[model samples]
Target: MEDSTHTGALLVVGAGPGVGMAVARRFGGVPVGLIARDEVRLRAMTETLRLEGRTVASAAADASDPTALRAAIGRIIAELGGIDTACFSPLPPVATIKRAAATDAEDLLTALALVVGGAATTVRAVLPGMLARGSGRLLFTTGSGALHPSPERASPAVYTAAQTAYIDVLRRDLSGRGVAVAHVAVVGPVGADGHRPEDVADALHDLADEGGSTVLHLTEGAR
Candidate 1:
């Protein structure tokens, strides 16, 4: 829905070639705004989506930096109009995926900053508009680690747990306010069996249409 007063754009944070690209593509007519730490990837994806005939905007911002992330989002909103849906797809830092015994204070802080803090910053950046509009979607793509953790990856386990909890609380807080907060938990790598990135994108569309807080578990042969 295009409006001269509101942007109603889809903002994909951590817009990589995988789900991010697929999600943007699935939105079809809606303008898509993409954020990523890799400028080259951002530019390339923007171009690719444009070639595919989608109106798109790209900004480079690391997910862990709240200020940079917010600034990038602000630019996107300014350029595209407004964010109708915000999809957070970034994962915790690579260093945090080590053994439990190897985890440290810095690791914990980094994990929390990106997973929990980043999400908060991103959501806060757009919540005002969403609330004003009385309808919007906040979507998070997390690993199955959030629900069933692997002891080997201590940091992800911790980060995902916190991320899930924060989303859960947000969903409760926004209930009946006409905002939809949903989580998509992938049991394995995003592309499995017949489940392509476009399929995941389709799932996101379905969740937004449903307009409520819920989690969709993705696995092979389950699409």
Candidate 2:
């Protein structure tokens, strides 16, 4: 079911030490572009991948800033030639946990901007090209809290749920248009138990090749 043709750069937003690096490693030979907020870590990741003989480029941008994030994406496209596949995994460790009633408005908005608005902006940047070519892959890494909301993670749950809803609509809107929109929900610690980052990366590649939208749930016991 994997498409043999359609070679283009894989743009990974929120490229960090975990899912981002793992995905790039799984798709080793392809040209890769990484986007993250940390310039030092981004550079180091690029160099690490380059040492493996993988063609890689990196740019740093805050996901909450749409203008900057899109500009960074443009640089990646320019550096890697083109992008046909994109993976978004931007969640960071929660600094402060709050109940829904106690959460601040700005905090909720910030969460939405990073998780939902950020993805929208990135998609808007690359979608035209993909739609023109009639082929592309968009994958988002979602937290399990979205599916199973918890009072402890009230803020993230709200934004992530919104993100999931948005992806659902996007998949429907782009149906039969050759774009694959997928949501991969993380139910537990990414590398804990049998849920290897490598396996998650492999699944993402498979989804890209298949060219359809679907939800994939990964837990400790089930990959």
Candidate 3:
């Protein structure tokens, strides 16, 4: 395992496309750990990184599952020492739009569980060593939901609430703890020309490297 802070192992929890890929590429040349539920996407990203001659690894797991997530993190730590920065962007591709009354209770609960629970899982898995080592970066992605939560889209509204709650927790409790916790809220659709997942990823790692102990509130800085 390589020391992430020292050697630059950026663990991208949701390395699908858009912002996730953008972040991964921005911090080029460092060993990167890409985590995602989709095998194809993970493989594609991993291959791209490897082709570019950068150290890369991939893991398939549901971020909401703490045990599974931790296991994956362990593998990453084993390969890259410890994670210098982690970007948590678990946005589903399809629009999860559901009318308030028609919303599925189970689905909504699961979404909330994954979004918030995964944030906690990812942080907890790495926080211990990061704290002890006295350096790390923890960042999460929030889109339109964080800025303007809609009650009409009940499922998204719920997810947004949880995402915001997690960001607030990071800002309040974890910001100044040697490991800088930052929030990048892409208020619009995040993509290549937009404020995509990769965009958030880049911000996360860059801030982590800066290590200013500042709580970044990037509300759509660049798309």
Each candidate's number of clashing pairs is 1, 0, 16
Those runs of model 2 whose alpha carbons end farther than 4 Å from true positions after fitting are: 1-5, 192-194, 211-223
Per-model C-alpha lDDT, please? 0.81, 0.79, 0.71
Query: What value does the lDDT take at residue 80 in candidate 1?
Result: 89
Candidate 1 residue spans exceeding 4 A from truth: 1-7, 192-195, 211-223
Clashing pairs in 2: none
What's the lDDT of the predicted structure labeled candidate 3? 0.71
27-95 in candidate 1: lDDT tens per residue?
A: 667899999999988999999989987789889998889999999999999998878889998844877
TM-score of the candidate numbered 1?
0.90
RMSD for all candidates, in order, please: 3.0, 2.6, 3.9
Measured against the true structure, the TM-scores of the candidates, in listed sequence, are: 0.90, 0.90, 0.83
The local lDDT score (0 to 100) that residue 223 gets in candidate 2 is 45
